[model samples]
Target: MRIQNAFRLALVGTLGVGAGLLILSAVASLSTILTYVGVALFLALGLEPAISGLERRGLPRWAAILLVVLGVAALVAALLLTVIPIIVEQVGELIALIPVIIAQLNRVDWIEWLQEQFPLLKIDEISEQAAAALTDFFTNPDKLSELLGGVWQVALAIGSGVFAVIVVAVLTVYFTASLDAMKRATYQLVPASRRARFADLTEQITQSVGRYVIGQVSLAAVNGVLSFAFLSIIQAPFPAVLAFVAFLFSLVPLVGTLTGSIIIVLACLIPGVGSPLTALVAAIYYLVYMQIEAYVLAPRIMSRAVRVPGALVVVAALAGGALLGILGALVAIPTAAAILLIIKQVVIPRQNER
Candidate 1:
C-alpha cells in the first residue's frame, strides 16, 4: 500500500512538471502574436484620452472614436504622400555619394587636422584600406550578388513590417471601441468587495499611460520639425531623411534625443556632405536644444503623466530596455507608476492592518 501511494505521488508530480513545460513552450511559440496584441492594446490605451475628451463635450462614443481614428489616418496619409518620397530621394542621393565621399576623405580639413594632431594614428592608411575594400566590393561579382541577396532580405522585412502594422491597426480600433466593455469584464473578475477599488486603480493607470504616450509623441514631433527646419536652414545634407531619423529615434525615452542628435551631427561631418564649420554649428544647436528639452519641455509635458522618482526612472528604463528593447523602455515609466500606486494604496493598507 505504501509503495503504491508513493508511486502515485511521483506520477502526479511528473505529469505536472511536463504540463508546465508544455505551457511554456506554447507561450514561446506564440510570442509574436502576443507582441502584436500588446502593442495594439498599448496604442488603444493611448487614444483613450482623446476619446474621453470628445465624450466630455457630449459626443457619442462611436462618433468620437470614428473622428479620432479618421483624423489619425488622414495625418498618416498626408505624411506618407508628402514626406516619404523626399526622404527616399535623399537616401538614394546619400547612397550614390558614398564612393565620392570616401575618395575625398583625405581632403576634409578636419581629417587633416586630426592626422596632424595625432601622428601615431595612421588615419591616411586606414582611409586608403577602406577605400580599396569598398572599390573591390563594388567591382566583385560575388559581392554584388551578396548585396542583391541583402536587398531581398530587406524587401522581405519591409513586407512583414507592413503586415504587422495592418494587424496592429485593426486590433487597436477594435480594442479602443470595446475598451469600456473590456474594463467592465475585467472588473468582474475581481471579488465583489474589491471590484470598485480595482476598477478605480485600473482607470488611473490607463489614464497615466494615455497621457504619457501623448506627451512623448508631442516631444518627438517638436524635435522632428525643429531638426528639419534647422538642418535645412544650414543646408545640411539630407535634411528630410535626417529629420525622419530624428523623429523615429525621439520616440524612445531618456537617451533617444541625445542619440539622434549625435547621429545627425556625425552625418553633417561626412565628407562632401558638410564641412567642419557645419558640423560645429549643428553640434552647438543640438546642445542648446537638449538643454531646452530637458529643462523646459520634458518637465512641463511629463509632470502629470508620470510621477516616478529620478532614480527609479533610470533603473526602470535600463531594466526595461535590457529585457524588451524599445517597447519595454517606452512603457516602463507608466508601469512603474501603476506599481507604486498599488503599493501605496493596497500593500501599505494591508500591512497596517497586519
Candidate 2:
C-alpha cells in the first residue's frame, strides 16, 4: 500500500511537469497569434460605435457589422490603389536624385565655412568618398548582393504583414459579429452579484475605446492633409510620400506628430529639392501647428473620448513604444485611459467608501 501511494505521487508529479512544459512551449509559439487576436479584438471594439448606431437605427446587428467591415475594406483598398504608386515613384526619384543633392550641398556656404575653420574638415573628400561608395555599391556584385538580400528581407516582411492583416481582418469580423454574445458570455463569467457592475464597466470602456480610435484616425488624417499642404507650399519634391509618412507616424501617441513633422522638415532641407528658407518655413509651420493641435484640435477631438494628463500621456507612450514598438505606442493612450477609468470608477470609489 505504501509503495503504491508513492508511485501514484511520482506519476502525478511527472504529468504536471510535462503539462507545464507543453503549456510554456505553446505560449512561446503562439505569442504572435495572440498579438493578432488582441489587435483584432481592439479594432472590433473601436468599430463598435458605428455598429451600435446602425443597430439603433433599426438595422439588423449582422448587417451593421457587415456594412462597417465592407466600408473599412473599401476605404483601405481605395487608399492603397491611389497612394502606393505615387509613393513608389517618388521613392525612386528621391534615391536617383541623391548624388545631385550631395553635389549641391558641396556648394553651400556652411560647407565652405566649415572647411575654412576646421582646415581638416575636407568636405570635398567626404563628398567624393560618399559618391564613390554609392557608385561602388551599385557597381560591385558583392554589394549588389547585399542590396538584393535587403530586398528579399523586405519581401518576406511584406508577406508576413499581409498574413497578419488577413488574420486580423477575419478575427475582427468574427468579434464584431458576435460582440453582444461575447459581452454576455463575459458577464456570465462574473459572480451574479458583481455581473451588473461588470457589464456597465465593460460598456463604458468599450465606448471610450471606440471614440478614441475614431478620434485618433481623424487627427491623423488632419495631420497628413496639413503636411501635404505645407510640403507643397514649400515645393518639397515628395509631398505625397511625406504626407503618407506623417499619416502613419501620427497614428502613434504623443511624440508621433512631432516626429513626422521633423522628418518632413528635414526632407524639405535636402540640398537639391529644397532651400534653407523652405526648411525654416516648414519648421515654423510645425511649431505653430503643434501648439494649435495641443491647445485646440486634440482637446476638441479627443477630450470626449479619454482625458489623461499630459505627463501621463508622455510616460505611457514612451513605455509602450519601448515595449512593443509602434503598436504599443498606438494603443498606449487608450490603454492608459481604460486603466484610469477603472481606477476612478472602481478603486478610488471603493477606497473612499471604506
Candidate 3:
C-alpha cells in the first residue's frame, strides 16, 4: 500500500513538471505579444493622471481620453512630417562630406603625430577601409541587390511592428477609460478586512508611476529644447534632427541626458560642416545644462512624483536596459519605487509584527 502511494505521488509530480514546461514554452512563444501588452498597460497608467486632471476640469472621461489621444497622434504626425525629411537630407550630406573629411584629417598635425608615434597603427589604411566599406554599402550594386532581396522581410517586420503599435494604442485607450472600474474590480479580490489597505497601497503605487511618467516627459522636453537652441546658436548643421534625437534619448533615466549630449556634440563635429570649436562649445553647454538639471530642475520636478535614491536609480536603469532595452529602462524607476513602497508598507510592518 505504501509503495502504491509513493508511485502515485511520483506520477503526479512528473505530470506537473511536464505541464509547467509546456506552459513555459507557450509563454516563450508569445513573449513578443506579452511585451506589447505590458508596454500598453504602462502607457495607459502613465496617461491616467492627465485623464484624471481633464476629468476634474469638467470633461467626461471618454472626451478627455479622445482629446489626449488625438493630441498625441497629431504631435507624432507633425514630428514625422517635419523631422524625417531634414534627417534624411543631413544623412545624405554627411555621407558626401565623409571623403572630404578624410582628406582634411590626413592634413592635420595630430594625425601625422599619432601615426608617427604608433608606427603599427595605420590611420590612413583604417580610414580608407572605413570609407570603402561605407561607399560600397551605399553604392555597390551587389549590396543594393542584397538589401532589395530582404525588402519583403523588412516589410513583414514593419507590418508586425505597426500591428503591435495599433494593438498597444487601442489597449491604452481602453485601459485609460476603464481604469477606475478596473481598480474597483481589483480591490474586490482582496478580503473585506484587507481591501482598504490594498486600495491605499495600490493608489500610492499608481500615483508614483503617473508622476514619474509626467516628470520624465517634461525633463526630456526641456533637454531637447535646450539642445536645439544651443546647436542653433553654434551654427550646427541639422539642429532639428539632432534635437529630435536628443528628445528621444533624454527619455531614459540617469545616463540619458549625458548620452543625448554626446550625440549632439558628435553631430556638431560632422566632417565638413562641424568644427572642433563648435563641438567644444556644445559639450560645455551640455555639461552646464546637466549640472543645472541635476541640482535644480530634477529636485523640483521629480520630487513630487517619486523619491528614488540616486544609486538605486542607476542600478535600476542599467539592469532594465540590459534585460529589455529602452522600454525596460523607461519603466524601471517606477518599478523600483513600487518595490520600495511594498517593502516599506508591507514587508517592514510584517517583520515588526513578527
lDDT of each: 0.92, 0.89, 0.88
Error of 3 at 86 (Å): 4.2
Model 3, C-alpha of 35: deviation from truth (Å): 1.6
RMSD of 3: 3.9
* Clashes found in each candidate (C-alpha, N, C closer than 3 A): 0, 0, 0
Summing lDDT over every window of 10 consecutive residues in candidate 3, give the lowest-scoring window.
105-114
What's the CA error at residue 341 for candidate 3, in Å? 1.4
Give every collision pair in model 2: none
* Candidates 1 and 3, the one with greater TM-score: 1
Which regions of candidate 2 are displaced past 4 Å? 1-26, 95-99, 102-117, 120-148
lDDT of 1 by residue, 152-216 (tens): 99999999999999999999999999999999999999999989999999999999999999999
Model 3 lDDT tens row, 92-157:
887888899899876778767878999899978887898899998989899988889799789999
Q: Scored by Cα lDDT, where does model 2 land?
A: 0.89
Clashing pairs in 3: none
Question: TM-score ranking from best to worst?
Answer: 1, 3, 2
